[model samples]
Target: MVAPMSVWPWGNLGAFKYLLFGPFLAQVLYSRMGEDTAKSSWCLHLLIIWGLRLFIHLLLGSFGNMLFLNQTRRIIKQGVDFKQIDREWDWDNFLILQAFVAFMAYYIFPSLADLPLWNTRGLITVLVLHIGASEPLYYWVHRCFHGKYLFTNYHSLHHESAVPQPVTAGHATFLEHLILTAIAGIPILGSNWLGHGSLSLVCGYLVVFDVLRCLGHCNVEFIPYRIFERLPFLRYLIYTPTYHSLHHTDLDTNFCLFMPLFDAVGNTLNSKSWQLQKELNSGCGNYRRDIPDFVFLAHVVDLSSSMHAPFVFRSLASLPYATRLFLLPFLPIPFVVMLAMWAWAKTFVISFYNLRGRLHQTWAVPRFGFQYFLPFAAAGINKQIEEAILDADKLGVKVISLAALNKNEALNGGGTMFVNKHPDLKVCVVHGNTLTAAVILDDVPKDVTEVFLTGATSKLGRAIALYLCRRRVRVLMLTLSTERFEKIKKEAPADCQNYLVQVTKYQAARTCKTWIVGKWITPREQSWAPPGTHFHQFVVPPILSFRRDCTYGDLAAMRLPHDVQGLGSCEYTMDRGVVHACHAGGVVHLLEGWTHHEVGAIDVDRIDLVWNAALKHGFKSVSAPRTTSSSKSNFIS
Candidate 1:
């Protein structure tokens, strides 16, 4: 339970806490517009500090994620869960509070407004004051917080994140942070009082402090063991992530803030700290490095959606993906990252989670979804997919599922080329289009005897057509290619062959209330459907909702089983704990221990079987929030 003293006055404000800075921001703007430029730097200083703290926190988190992916220098093996992400979501609250404190300090000591840009002596002053005053002051105060009274009320909130990330360093209760801000301000304030202070000194000292704090909590070992081995006394001067991690795990040892020297002097240092540091540095620690049972091969949807990757923004990634106006300024960064990936073109693991004691990971091809449509990109995209599949095969992965574009017919014949090329491979290559078809088919109402279908020549379209025909449901297959339509119709049983009809015009489906869109459709084409027509889509970048009288279904998706753990990030635009049907399809294959390759043509006969397996495994169909109870039951049941 949170103690009354620890609760922030404006804690409930959340994002609205920025409103507190409005007065300060307005002052800066007014100063910039008028002749009063003295307070401008000071006001801007507060804003810049907040921005820098946020930047470094995100930067370190991104770097840590990259290390986790490369699997070399990560100190902790466990991924951050949704709870930790949400807990650290308001990490910048302290920065905003600190700005208020600084404003009060400046009001009391107006001389601070006239500081020099640089002071050589200020560096020495900051170093001496921080070491002599701040370090020991923090050590004793930190130990006291661990006592029963404070631990339960205040300190425990910060310690909640066992496997800490960069943002974790700033996640503390209001009272705990109030004490910390004083400890951090000592050196800078001392330097100012001693007449050795400079703007550069304050900025430089704070930035370094933020960097080291983030580094210690980053859960990644970066300091080489050789550094401590070369100079034995250095271990006591500076602490590593391993040393600080022990403080969280052991709860009684390694209590020094950044310098282990105080811990040693206080006799609170963990004896195992040096050994664990050695083990992590040597890359043979107890950290988990197990091979995943299944891999979901996915690609970036576009420049904007790319930022939804787990490494970019933990808070944004935790929710379903959508374009945010604030993210537009950072679009160029993703463009640069995309170009960098293109230069180093390859597949890399982006995120992973565990379910039912099985490891599953999502791997990304460097190419974006739009690139798949470029004529020149087809070969490179195929090559990356092939390499990912081969690597999974070599790693003894039980199954690898291809994303929509990866299994495009024009790219690699729905992944048939990879399976046929390596016919003897043990790993199951799955397109997962069977489950995609099943999900779309399940959404159709039972009484609907006739349905309109688009993209009839594609793999999913073909499977859907054949499956519906077998049910004696008349399928209006929209395609210009009669030859392709005839081929799909011939695959159906002789008795159901008459259920499939070829149509080249949207006018043919004017009366059909159920429309399955396997391809993109224009607003004009969508208008051809009758009023109240419900559109079920399997297309990437789903079609627009144009008619108020009609409802549109979301892309095929399923909520993961209740047992899923460490699934902090959403899959693309899917909701938390929900994934595209293709991804779930691959997982079902792994759980069912199916050894057969699910590539090439989707088995129409296995639609019900796969759907049943998904249901048996507790996977539920995901319906749009706007779907009414009557509409939801028609699809979900």
Candidate 2:
């Protein structure tokens, strides 16, 4: 018969201390505890502290629903929808089960707790070894559970709540929870059995560590990164709020527990995704990745040939109506220019290349225009031409070559025209017909950066653009005709301008590239505002700089300065005492101190000015008032 271990007479007192007094003592000790003293007393002290912390959290957790409900109500009233605040009792049950399993596995399993390995000296060594061993062990086991077979059956439940709530931490199948707990606990038990430490020390370490784990999973935002991340060694040793938040947001990243170092080393950390989520949560405008190719392709196929198609159906649906009106007219311009240039490049540029047979020569044109396309269309195209020309002074070869046939046909047209326009533009335009341009590209001055073709279709231009992208040449495709420009803009990829370079017939490609690189063109130049009015007045502080009494043209010319951080949306408001300009999202009041003056509820002239200002600030379309939905009202109320 197994001998039953009797509870200590002071066990209840110890429990009380563990659940209450210990944490308070730990807080006090945190300030005064010397490094050696802290390390020496870690097991005894942490056992008491963690016991108390865990008990307090569990005690408070009984009312966790009420707390969440209150928070939900507050958030709803603050404009966030109630539906967005996920309230699921299922998650609570899951978290409880996970905790229960972890406790049972750590405390109950005799093979682990009674291991002969951990009967050694010192609490700090035991704690560190336990933690170091637990992480890698847990990682591998967790990864195995994510395997196709196990994932479908057990792991899927945990993943159901991608935007994990506080209650989501422990939500898993009982079996899955048991498996995970065992995976975490078995290593510590094995470490102890290996003669590394004592069971008492292990228990104390487990208690404190588990309490911190629960606190980390809790949605309490009291301990922010700004405070905790500033700490010297603590930043690296312990998990911070931001670390777990990223795990919840992006399931694939930040898999390591306790510290991010392992995840960083393993290349599983996603800092960018985490940063993006933080920005979104802070009410910085909705940030989404540029539309995926398949989605963009769907839009193009569905809305092709319709003028309203580009305006009515696009990722720009989020823009204000005024902004839409201002920007929509220009949407078709890039497409049309792209198409015409494609035609010109195929007909003339490739033909010139084929006729010359001197495909090795480099061409130079102004740095701007469909340079992004050169990589894919032409094999052996020099990649360095695009990189070296970061500024006018650093500009390299002025001429580039075009392949006869390649994948993206769109480039064959516009790209050709863009290259041909440069005075020193060289062409290696190839022709299958045996009839080609007599110009040997090498014979042309090395100053040629642009190339033109009269035969390529939009398809060919796309090929050239893709080719240039591979070679890293920033080729610009230009069109002389407005109609054609619109077609090309509509047909071209969203990143085409950045890569392929699109220009109107009127603008000099070389001059345009120079201006763009130099940032010389003012917002008024780029914007569709009326001439003469200064857009500079609208250019306000860090968020937006707007010119006062600026015409649409003036607003257009006002490019966002390079130094501005976190640029989102620019807004113009003509409300109250003076024409007020503000950025959208954050609350900015006019008065120095509190005076009951709402900027939105100003004079009618101010309202008109605000509308004009929004237009000047580049709002695409304003949202029309909708009949208040019951759901929306409930959420807001």
Top-TM-score candidate index: 1
- What value of lDDT does candidate 1 attain over all alpha carbons? 0.86
Which 10 consecutive residues of model 1 have the lowest summed lDDT?
628-637
lDDT computed for candidate 2:
0.34
Give the Cα error of residue 290 in candidate 1, in Å.
3.0
Question: For each candidate, what TM-score against the reference?
Answer: 0.95, 0.30
lDDT of all predictions = 0.86, 0.34
Model 2 Cα displacement at 244 (Å)? 2.1
* TM-score of candidate 1 on Cα atoms, chains taken together: 0.95
lDDT of 1 by residue, 1-637 (tens): 6576687888777566778989889989999999767787788987888778778888888777663354556666667777877777777777888889988888877777899999999999999999999999999999999999999888898898857788888888898889989999999999999999998888898899989998988888878889998899999899998898888889999888799999999999999998898887776746536688999999899999999877887777787777778789989999999999987868988888889988888999998888999999888888889999999999989999999999989889989999989998888999888888888888888888999999988999899999899889999999999899889988999999999999999999999999999999999999999998899999998888888889999899999999887788888777778899999999999999999999888888899999999999999988663332211100000
Model 2, position 637: C-alpha lDDT score: 5
Q: Lowest summed lDDT over 10 consecutive residues: which window, candidate 2?
A: 292-301
